[model samples]
Target: MSTAELRYANQFEIIRSEEKDRYLISQLSQQLDELYTKLFGLNNFHIYQPYLHRLSELLYYLTTTLSNRQTIGEEYVCLIQYDPITKRIPSLMRRLFMIFFRIFGDLISKYFLTTFLIRPIAEDFFHPKLSLQTIELITRFIITSIERTHKISFYLTGYYYNISKILTRIRYLIYSRSTSESIEIQSNMNKTIKLLSLCLCIQHIIETYTSLKQVALSISQHRNQLNLIAEEEKEKEKKIVSEDITSSTDYVRCPLCYELAISNVALVPECGHVFCWQCIHTWVAENQTCPLCKTNTTQSRIVHLINY
Candidate 1:
């Protein structure tokens, strides 16, 4: 061999020797085999069972090949030990299968799991016994929560982006500006206040978003309970309406603000309290607590009545 080739061969042999001496590879192979078996057994009913089987077969082939290889110095052991023509095709097929599996796994776990499955499962688990009216209320609450989260996310993202841009501009200005006393003082003060305001804004947004998300999750989790309470409430309401049918100028008292109103009304759930839409909306916006018993009003929405 030429001098350069000899040097390359020596380095390759060193790498091979180091790798062979390490027990980590053997341990990893054993662990992988166990994992493959467990996964295969569990995933027999999966739609991608064939693909999984192919992956397991490929893994076994690779593991066996690696185990049988002799760590000879400076010699490149042929990775493919079977017939060149037949083995080549299976090897290529295995490679393609592995590539596709990895791509699909990444896409499903990264995007589909969070976006489609988890949220829906949570919603369904919480809202099992829902009537049409209750469903509408829950839907409105969820939509509002999601919209609020999105708005907060967008606002924070913009704020950070602007702050980063401003910092970059400030850095450039500092490096290029002449060192005058007045300029130095002004720049320092501007940067300090800018950074402080940015930090405060980010902190406030994060806290608000976290609070909203927790409230949404709580509402989602208790959807079944909420539905039951709503049903009980509707029954009580029917009785009240029957009793008030004979009165010409009957008005339901506003449960939240205690303001007497004739229009745009909503029913406070569980407690069977009646209130105007504007009163409930303002109360929910401020305290998120029932005016009577301090029950949560986080998921409450305005219900408009249609007079037939």
Candidate 2:
């Protein structure tokens, strides 16, 4: 291979390795980045802080729909310019509103947005210009997001390794103690140490999350197997059940209650268990299986048996 090809191969390998060890590297990278930040007085990187806002933008939507407020982009601006500027909503009330908004958002995005809106629109006009535009937008957005995450991850990692080299070059200044170091200097060191501790906690939490996710997946599999086993057992029981022998040759009787099916409606369930309408309905409502075979059955699976 040429030099350029070899370089590209190495780059690809690095990318693949980084992706594989992304989570593991993040903790080290974060701590090192913070350490470098403290040593060199780097600006604290703050992006998308969710805690400062008591209420979300959903409040703006509510205001627009309920109180005829303008659909202003900014939440703070919307709140201030409103007629109720003098009135102050309680902290508890704001929290309650936030909770309600979260629930409503989940429900709407799950059912209404996906089922009613997105599904219909996509199904109807999937091959049209709208879909093309949507696809392009989504593709571009995804590419951009991936690029940003990659850049940040690498930058942090670089900081972690690069800081040592930088520190080694500037060690003279760091080691040289001229006078009493300011309280702020001590505070910065403390903060840096605390941040490194936090990074450790974050890594542990991530590992725990991965472990818990595996456990949850295993539990889900077991639950599904249990359901399947229950279904099979129900089927076996349904097969073992003796057909109800009645006094007359013309009519079949329900095994349960041991009586001739007097009702006009005859119930033949999916398990081939013959029963009276009311009897099967009652039985299924309780047991959800054929009385004889223990086979799985439901109200929907029950059919009417007609004799000529």
Each model's backbone clash number: 0, 7
TM-score of each: 0.20, 0.21
Residue 78 displacement (Å), model 1:
62
Clashes of 2: 7
TM-score of 2: 0.21
Off by over 4 Å in 2: 1-198, 201-214, 217-308
Which 10-residue span in candidate 2 carries the lowest summed lDDT? Answer: 167-176
Shift in Å, residue 304, candidate 2: 39
lDDT values for all models: 0.47, 0.45
Candidate 1 lDDT, tens digit per residue, 171-236?
100112234664577567556656655776676667667766665665655675677788999999
- C-alpha RMSD by candidate, in order: 27.0, 24.2
Residue pairs clashing in model 1 are: none
* Model 2 alpha-carbon miss at residue 269, Å: 40
